[model samples]
Target: MLTVYAYQKCSTCRDALKWLRDRGIPHEVKAIRETPPTVAELESVLSGTGGDIRKLFNTSGVDYRELGMKDKLPTMDQAAALELLSSNGNLVKRPFVTGDGKTLVGFKESDWAAALG
Candidate 1:
């Protein structure tokens, strides 16, 4: 089963969950704001993103802007970045899905279909 970390108030997250339900995909949902992904999980997603640590972040989130992540991210190392993400769920992108050796962030219908279908 897939594990999806999502913020309940986020429309994107809701859409992703709906998509999963509509497709009959088996998954468990965790509130991203309450329980961020573990470091290991983040690392797995980072690897899937071709080692682009930035891709794992919710760049457009309020926390990102308030914390100035855009300016600070370029200088942070991978471990530091992952630690921050693991500690703060709001900094993670919505609908973070991982399972079955696949990792995905955000919601792109085609991408999800290709990966989960």
Candidate 2:
């Protein structure tokens, strides 16, 4: 089953949900703020995404900026990055979806369609 980690107030997340429904894809949605993903889960996502952990981060978010990740990302280790992401759900990308051994961050309609197809 597909698991979607999303923030309720995020328009992108809402759009992603709509896209999933439109495509008749079944998914389980979890409120990111209420239930942050674990390190293991993040590891899976990172691996599935070919180790582009930066893509899994909410780079533009206040939490990210406040945490000084913008300047520190290039120097941080994977473990440190994952720790920061796990510390604050808002610092992670929205609409993080994983299933069928595939992990996707953010929502691009074409990308999602291709994945689902």
Candidate 3:
């Protein structure tokens, strides 16, 4: 089953949810702000995403800037990055979805269709 980690107020998350429903895709939604994914889960996401750890971050979020992750990303290791993300679910990317060994960080209808297909 597809698992979606999302924030309630995020438009992207809402869009993704709508997209999934419209497509009749089966998915389980989790409130990321209330319960963040674990390091192991993040690692799995990174691995399935072809090692693009940056894709796992909410780059446009306030948490990203407040933590100075933009400037410190280059120096961070996977473990450190996961630690930061775990500290605050808002720091992690929105509408994070995974299923059948596939990981998607954001809502892209075309991409999701292809992946699900």
Candidate 4:
């Protein structure tokens, strides 16, 4: 089954969920804040994004700013960055989807159509 790591209050996550529902795409919704993705799962998802760790972060999130990740991330090693993200869902991009050999960050209707269709 496909899994969507998302925060319930995020509008983008809502839209992504709707997009899947409208298309009759089955998925399991996981509250990112309550249960963040595991390190292995994050690694799998990262592969789909071409190993660009920056894409895995929620750049606009409060935590990202509060923690000064924008400045710190560039200096952090891959392992440290991955560990930080795995421990905090608030730092991850919303509606992170993983399934069918693909992983997606955030919501883009066209992207979903191409990836899932």
Model 4, 1-117: lDDT tens per residue?
689999988999999999989989989999999898888888998888888899999999999999999899988998898899899999999889887677888899898889998
Model 2 bad stretches (over 4 Å): none
lDDT of 2 by residue, 18-99 (tens): 8889888899999987887888888988986778889889888988888888789999999988987887899889888877
Whole-model lDDT, model 2: 0.87
Q: Which should have the higher lDDT, number 1 or number 2?
A: 1
Question: What C-alpha lDDT values do all the predictions have?
Answer: 0.94, 0.87, 0.86, 0.90
Question: Candidate 4 has what TM-score?
Answer: 0.96
Pairs that collide in candidate 1 are: none
Q: Candidate 1, after superposition: displacement of residue 117 in Å?
A: 0.8
Off-target runs (Cα >4 Å) in candidate 3 are none
Model 2 RMSD to the real structure? 1.2
Clashes of each: 0, 0, 0, 0
TM-score of each: 0.98, 0.92, 0.92, 0.96
Best by lDDT: 1
Q: Which regions of candidate 1 fall more than 4 Å away from where they truly are?
A: none
Which of candidates 2 and 3 is the stronger one according to TM-score? Answer: 2
* Model 3, span 33-65: residue lDDT tens: 888887877888888678888999999999889
Which stretch of 10 consecutive residues in model 3 shows the poorest summed lDDT? 96-105
Clashing pairs in 3: none
